[model samples]
Target: MTRTALVVRGGWDGHQPIEATDLFLPFLRDSGFEVTIEDSPEVYRDAERLAATDLILQSVTMSEISAEALTGLRAAVAAGTGLAGWHGGIADSYRNSSDYLQLVGGQFATHPSTHPDARHGEASDNFLDYTVEITDLGRTHEITRDIADFTLHTEQYWVLHDDLIDVLATTTHPVQPYHPWHRPIVSPAVWTRLWGEGRIFVATPGHSPEVLQDDNVRTIVERGLLWAARSE
Candidate 1:
């Protein structure tokens, strides 16, 4: 059976939802999935449309989705449809909606910089080479099947997440003079969880278009989508 995907892209323009999603759409199509792109969250309200979809790729951030739309989406996932997203587009999206947060399983907090002034000045310059460490690798999961440890220059996410997430990769944040926290923190970079029979995959990279286009980042995301959409 040919799989179908709903690609919803619209929210904070800073995240470049439109441009970043454009990169992934062709990838999905080339992978043999029938793809549909929607700019509005209205599609979430259509139960029939959502129920027919095999996967949902959301790039929305910091926007409020209607309760009806939220309800329909939760129902679809619970009934075994897959959902996947990245960074603020998914993890930091719809802050007011606890229901959305509960489903996605994490919230983006802060990316403490090497220079405190990086946030106001040129934060992109502080985008250092960082490695995403494979944490729990014993499970024979398709997402991390042949994937090895990789490095990227992007905004590493410090997320507040649930224990239910099967953390596939993590990055350690060492306490530096700039950050006086004095604690070694491990942040989850990639993770997967099952919500009912449905699969959900989230990667906390892709802070910019360049990051999304990175070879390693692209490969991880591609595998993530496939893993999320995989059926028993």
Candidate 2:
């Protein structure tokens, strides 16, 4: 049977939800997903719509979801509908919504930058380099299996996460000018977890379509979506 995959894209344009989600469309289609795209999270209120979904790719950034909408979403995931997202879309989204944070297994606190860019004169200039080391768990996980370590020049997500999450890939952050904290913070760059029978996948790398277009991000996210769909 053809699986149903919902792609909801909207929120802060800085994350370019439309463009970023667009990069994953062909993959979803090629993988046998009957794709549905929505520009708002309000679509979650349609109980019948969500009940028919197999997987959901939420690309909204810091947008607030209504209590009713969030209730529908949380119920669907817990009842075996898969959820997947990246960056601020899934991680940094709805800061005030503690339930959403718990559901995703993390909250984006900040993206610490170690770079000293006196030229730009702002902290945003500090988006520096980072390496994502695929973990042993990743080597065995269906989504990232056979993939090697990768690097990205984007925001290194410093998230407040649940320890029970199955960490797939990680990046070590060092103390720097912008990040005055002493100690190398080990952060999860990719992870997967179970919410009831549902699977959740998150990759904190897509800052733009260019970033999502990276060969590694593209391949991993594609497989990740397939894995979330339980298509294998």
Candidate 3:
């Protein structure tokens, strides 16, 4: 069967939604999907289109979606359309809509600066070396199995999430003398969620095109997209 995949991408040019999502176009096609691309979340309002979609790959970071559109999106997913995304594109999007946040399972809070002296607005402030430790569940989950702990120098998202999500991997923010945090803070680096009959996948590491190119990150994301699609 030819599964339909929809790519909704735009917002916050910093994340390079176009380029980042472009990286996976070939993979989606190779995976037997008939891919469609949209630059805004407005497409979510199309119930007929969404009903035919098997998966949704969203890359709009910090963007807004109308209440009606959000309703459509939630309904489609609940009816078995899969939703998957990486980094700020998914976690940081639609901040105004708590409904959207609830559907996604998490939200991006902050990426602490690498040093206290670093200026807040500088791009380099949030870039730091961090390790993603796979959870026991991750070792066995089809989306993350065979992946070992990996390190990266990029924006390490401190996400605000709930227990509803199944955490697959985690990254810890160590307490530094220069920072105010009293103890190490751990956050989910990769996770999945079940909503109705749908599957949702999220990864917090793809800050740039380079990060998406990492073998481990690339492999997990590719497999995740496939795993999230509506099952036969």
Judging by lDDT against the true structure, name the best candidate.
Answer: 3
lDDT for model 2 comes to 0.85
lDDT-based ranking: 3, 2, 1
Model 2: worst 10 consecutive residues (lDDT sum): 114-123
Q: Judged by lDDT against the true structure, how good is candidate 3?
A: 0.95
Tens-digit per-residue lDDT, 3-66, candidate 3: 9999999999999999999999999999999999999999999999999999999999997899
Encode model 1's per-residue lDDT on 1-232: one tens digit a residue: 7789999989899789999988988888988899999997778999998888989999998888999989988888988889998888888888999998899888888876767655556757557667887765613566766667888777878898999888988887777887868898898898988999899999889887889888767877898998888473
> Candidate 2 residues 8-126, lDDT tens each?
98989989898889888888888788999999988999989998999999999998899998998888888788899888889888777888888899778888754454436654564
Candidate 2, residue 202: CA error in Å? 0.3
lDDT (Cα atoms) of all candidates against the true structure = 0.84, 0.85, 0.95
TM-score ranking from best to worst?
3, 2, 1
TM-score of 2: 0.94
Superposed on all Cα atoms, the candidates' RMSDs to the truth, in angstroms, are 1.9, 1.7, 1.0
The residue-level lDDT of candidate 3 at 53 comes to 98
For each candidate, how many residue pairs have backbone atoms clashing (under 3 Å)?
A: 0, 0, 0
Residue 44 CA error for candidate 2 (Å)?
0.9
Between candidates 2 and 3, the one scoring higher on TM-score is 3
